[model samples]
Target: MKVGVKDLWAGGILIFLALLGLFINGGLLGIGLESHALGTARRMGPGYMPMLVFWLQLGLGCLVVFNAFSNGPDPLERWTKLDLTTLAISVSSGVILWRVMEAIGLNNNYIQVGAPCFVAMAVLAISPAWRPLGLVLASFAIFGLLLEPLGLILALVGLCVVSALADRDHNPVSVIGMTVSLCIICWFVFIYELDIRVPLWPTIF
Candidate 1:
């Protein structure tokens, strides 16, 4: 039996996520789960469903790992030194640029957000095949940073815009439509239905 590289990476990531979820929910270490009651299946608490889901994910991840080890004739993907160098430079430069901009008083929303995205895209552009990866990474990073300050809708818009850059043949109209649709769905699910206390618009405005 030969190890499958793809399966190994997938299973490893899944297992890590499952373990992270369990750790957070279980309140291990100094992390407190706070009022997350674990009610029965009939009357589920916030923790109940998440705990069950993580357990199931853990089981599935274990099965995937076993299959990875038991599978045959799977070749590993090649990652060149250039890829690692590009990633390192992009991340470090973005961080440095962000701090410098803040210190130099050029830290408006446009500069704060645009600098990182531009650096990621430019650095990864050297490897044209991996441009999508760059866009996705930058999108998520920016979204996380912007969520609290800029709010959910703006963060989603930023995410969609940056990620959409990956598709060269993408239409601007379709992109706008998709962004609007995503914002609506997220507002419905996370803000309205789930009642999460995240702001929809920028807090300052």
Candidate 2:
């Protein structure tokens, strides 16, 4: 079967993600797995999650390639000037943000989060379908900003609420109920079960 641009693009992206995951897992990103304390059960290795994710990505990429060869050609979607502009803006913004964050310091979580959210919102503001993604990014940025001062529960609640807003069909009551339930579950898993040192409630709360 003839390969189409969409297939090529999809395959390339999956392969890229797989490689990036491997790079991260291999400790080429400067944060080695050796730095993390290994639990008695060997479940706490720093590379464990990265390795799993990368392997999954690699598997999916292989599947994509196999499908590309086995299936019929896909129709190519034409990109308009607006699409090109959006792509350019998104890519440039991400690149610039990465460089700036690296030059300054990655320790600044606010900048790390805010820059990408700004880029997403700015680039996709014209598209209604993409507004949900923008909203999710914005919510994550806010979560990162509030994580320290507001504490984990509050930050999580804020994230859930704002992210839920992304879905136009979402009901506020259900959103709130789910958020509270999730917060409780997180508290039990991360705090009570794992005994992580982070605060559950805000200082003022």
Candidate 3:
């Protein structure tokens, strides 16, 4: 039943997801005991957040169901319409990227640098009208080149330039600045505060 402002479908689905999260926390389906809000007792477990989440999802789900039934027909699009062509392209492209990289002898688990290159190349080859192919390729290339010399943060900044070039209206300057600023902030947080290494890839300085 559709009741409230937007949609019961979306609301109900969200509520269901929350309930699922709750179930995982609840240890209902052969999971371990987790923390509950009251005070983290014996059977309850470690983290209390999940119990609260379960109650929230159940409550919201009920509310959503009630609203859905009370509401009239939606004035807007009710459900998401699938884009078959785009979906097909996306799936096929991921497979194509894997195959191409393996063929090129760039077989790494992450395949960080080359994977995006292959994907971009494949997309451009198949869909010439995409128009940002050149920029996309240039961006990844520049990023790889800068990755070692400038460090992860600076290289990311360089890549953002390439990203900006992909779209005419994208402001590269602002993006670069933002990227650098975020990196510094994240670096401080991850390094100083959390004591975590920032680099999953090569750590340049």
User: lDDT winner among the candidates?
Assistant: 1
TM-score of each: 0.60, 0.63, 0.41
Q: Report the Cα lDDT for residue 123, model 3.
A: 49
Name model 1 segments beyond 4 Å from true.
1-3, 24-74, 94-126, 167-174
Worst 10 residues of 1 by lDDT: 27-36
In order, candidate lDDTs are 0.79, 0.70, 0.59
TM-score of 2: 0.63
Candidates, ranked, lDDT: 1, 2, 3
Candidate 2's C-alpha runs over 4 A off are 1-15, 27-77, 93-110, 117-122
Q: After superposition, how far is residue 21 of candidate 2 from its true place, in Å?
A: 2.2
* lDDT of model 3, residue 52: 62
**Candidate 3 wrongly placed segments (more than 4 Å):** 1-83, 99-108, 112-151, 158-168, 199-205
Better of 2 and 3 by TM-score: 2
For residues 108-132, could you state the per-residue lDDT of candidate 3 as single tens digits? 7455445555454434434334436
Residue 7 of model 2 has an lDDT of: 64
lDDT head-to-head 1 vs 2, winner:
1
lDDT of 2: 0.70
* Ranking of predictions according to TM-score: 2, 1, 3
